[model samples]
Target chain A: MAHLTPTPVIEPLQDRTMILNMGPQHPSTHGVLRVILEIDGENVVRIMPDIGYLHTGIEKTCEAKFYQQVVPLTDRIDYLCPLTNNLCYALAVEKLLGMEIPPKAQWLRVLLNELTRINSHLVWLGTHALDIGAMTVFLYCFREREDILRIFEMVSGQRMMTSYFRIGGIALEPPLGFFEKVRDFADRFPSRVDEYENLLTGNPIWLMRTKGIARITAEDAIALGATGPTLRGSGVDLDLRRDMPYSGYENFKFKVPLGKEGDVFDRYMCRVAELRESLAIVKQALEGMPEGPIKANMPKVVLPDREKMKTEMEALIYHFKIITEGFSVPAGEVYQAVESPRGEMGYYVVSDGTAKPYRVHMRAACLANLQTLPLMCEGRLIADVVAAIGSIDIVLGEIDR
Target chain B: MALAPPITDLEKLKTHPALASLLDWNPGAIEGVKFDRDEMSIVIDRAHIRDACTLLRDHREFAFEFLSDVTCVDWYPSEPRFEVIYHLLSISKKERVRLKVRLDGSSPVVESITAVWPAANYFEREVFDLFGIRFSGHPYLRRIMMPEDWNGNPLRKDYPVEGYR
Candidate 1:
């Protein structure tokens, strides 16, 4: 009887937590990120992030290469906005050498960067929506993204890994009919954005999954080193291009979208708004497009024109020296940044008057922004994980790289 | 204000005599100002990093509130074996400064900045994972990029360039 009966007096038992490793290989992580979470009955108590699983030693590899050769590595960094990475690096190196880029090149850079921004957002929106079980949005996004990729192929001759932007300017002069194709895409893109908005903007499912989820205060976001859409979602007015203008962004007239509540929904809306802003910038670039040289006049640094090498002996010798011996940067270091689709993409380059860089480092925004994941996931349910990850809009190439 | 200068604290920093040492050297040797115009920074020795950083934080004029990035570089059996860089931010002044330290060969140990900026926890771990720099005060020093039982830091100078597990 005593064994079967419940004690009248109170007895206490210890509560234990369970630790689970999400991935160095799990597909949803978007990369090799392993998030160690402590759970109590499907509720997360603590989260620890494990990174560097895909560390390709890209930074160290940069040391063995000349400035121009490193553009290929930037393509692999985010894998989404390859042109943006190219531009950021080129700007930093150009600044180091105190070289001036022509207006046409600067404007063209803006145009391409904006297009690259659109491409990146579409991917993020599609993947984020799919992760939350909205299959149609993913399909629709991919349909339009394919067109963008085709255009990229037309201009750069490479689809995803286009190291199209060279140190001084573009690699190829935006191939024949490229401008018209971009214009056509820009013309139709606004309606397409609305279509995406129509499907998910007011949908109860999307709202439930996103709104009031993964909320971060402005102070907390900044304290965590957050930038781009994530920080904008928290209503921060800081924009690198606007506040610290680079690549002739001060000339463009586009609004920077902000969110009232730093939630998954807010971030989604901010990115959608950014899509429109990019289209506007692209249109402006084409309408005011200047007819001039794309690459700078630096024969030693910039690659020589294919025809010029045949006609000019000096051009031939310069080309040979650049590819064979490589150029040496002055002894110093510089950290340059630009607004990539994700956030602030910065490249820190150090030179000791050598063909190869003394040091090359990247401040990957995806990795930095993803650091706030645990803070966003702590109180939410397990199912909300998809929405939270979507909100951050991370590309593993950048995170793991 | 000349458009308020991109960074808020340019003139104030120029007035400080402590940073005057930079003016004596060629601008190229100091590298160039990065991110913004007002932001003042330069590289330093790896061994005296702790002392130098301590002074940077303690000094009245410089209040680097954040450590934005801590990354390493390997020159491949070259002059500068390892370059560990630290990016600092002064929120009050709205400026950023980068400090670099060089380690020529083995024993790539640099003082930890975890105390100065708590955000350094993740960054320092990445440096250790890639370049094998040992941060003395890191609470739970472990390889972030590799497995728990992994062998060598892949970002080192002598580390094989091509390998996969």
Candidate 2:
């Protein structure tokens, strides 16, 4: 067996090389990520990512909890796009039960998931710009992000940890006037994106820092298992929404944005373009919003309506049974993937005809995307390492989980 | 966004001539093939994973070039207590197939497919970290999400979810 220790390269300037631990607490590395960089003066020669400071043993914890209990835990896994995690887990469990969610639920899911994408991108833009020392853009980005968070509160009650999407459908019918509020934000969002572009897109300093920095070819990006904006920035025309449509994403009319250079600038442009496209999708969803039951018809799998639970004896018993003992999923496994803001987020869930999942493995996009940091960092200046990490848009919660 | 026609078909994958030929090429490597819930999966011997993945990636007709994920299921009381599953994808073909290799409960060890797909490095390490299933040829097979001196693989069924002794 090979030694588990990393073998550092003893190059010509070995004496000049020094290892720098970037962050377990530093602001720029995003979450509790510590990158051990082997540097020769300002140039990086090797990098090792030290993770797991935030490992909550969530996967192991899932094995002990019932299926529904796991959804809140999923939210904490990728806090940026918590709804995306919720939807992916719900879809996987629903597949096991062969449950068909109502058309309204599916459409609502597409709308909420798009909003999650926008919310996540807003944070990415704010922090990414802040890392590059563009102060005003951070404030501008947060202003818009606040609107999205408020909209989330309107629907899910909780701002960040929204365990909104349940196993069979959404937790509740969206509050009245929810569509109009989202519409008001969606109507004004394109110009906000333009506001961001005006601030940084054409600025020579912004261009210099982002245009060629952290560049990776499409082949290398794909080989490293990068997806979503990171892969799209590298000119890979793959979006799980368009390619493998789920949760009624196919019903809306929108474009799958692509970029050619696969650089920090291209990634920025791709995300900016995505912000516009997501607005378009949200508008389409609002126009085509279906009127039907929010939850699936399966009483065994889906919780009954509160109104019905009060009136009907059968509904009351079903509700009591489901609440006390979580509904059991079929003895099978399914892989459900969703196009999250970061990348292709997948949930590989296994059930053994039990209330608890036998195993639930999150195919976290951050973990895979973070692997390419060393590939992008080596042979580059230490300053660009921060830019590269920002461009990857990782939520270390997801990676460490 | 008009729904793209469904890209993956289990029936089509099961009958793919190239896939059939690959199965024929390695007579004893495959244990069984199953299509459940519209997904195609083939169970393979633990030792032949590298060879199987190589064929899956190299074959022109079944070019599963991307290794999406590597995970394990710990069936504690079952004879072969671990099942190492590999999710493979072909971007051009727009198809996905899972390859499963079951490892014995005692001394669970298998060949690593990092030779076939470089992306498998982190995923293999993660599997080893959580499941304590060692990859025989993995270059840096250390714990990924756990501390270096962690006591046990927390994912195994018998491993208590709460406190450690």
Best by TM-score: 2
Per-residue lDDT of candidate 1, residues B69-159 (tens digit): 7787676667667778887655445456777787766577877866655557777888887778889998767766565556777777676
Q: Per candidate, chain B TM-score?
A: 0.69, 0.88
How close to the true structure is residue B22 of candidate 2, measured as C-alpha lDDT?
A: 60
Q: What is the interface RMSD of each candidate, in Å?
A: 12.2, 6.3
Tens digit of lDDT per residue, candidate 2, span A324-388? 99888768888888889999899999989989999999999988898888888889999899999
Backbone clash numbers for all candidates listed: 1, 2
Q: Which ranges in model 2 have alpha carbons more than 4 Å from their true place? A: A1-13, B1-14
Error of 1 at B132 (Å): 2.4
lDDT winner:
2
Q: Which of the numbered candidates is closest to the native, going by highest DockQ?
A: 2
Evaluate model 2: give its lDDT. 0.87
For residues A1-401, write the lDDT of model 1, one tens digit per residue.
34222111222222676766777576567766667777766877776766666667677678778888999998988899999888988887877666778889999899988989999999999988988989999999998999899998998888889998888888878778999899899888889999999999999999999989988887777666777899899998766777667888989888999998999999999999999998999999999988899998878788899999999999999999999998876655667878888887888876777878767778888777887888899967766665787789888788777
Checking candidate 2 for backbone clashes, the offending pairs are A252-B1, A253-B1
User: All candidates: CA RMSD in angstroms?
Assistant: 8.0, 3.9
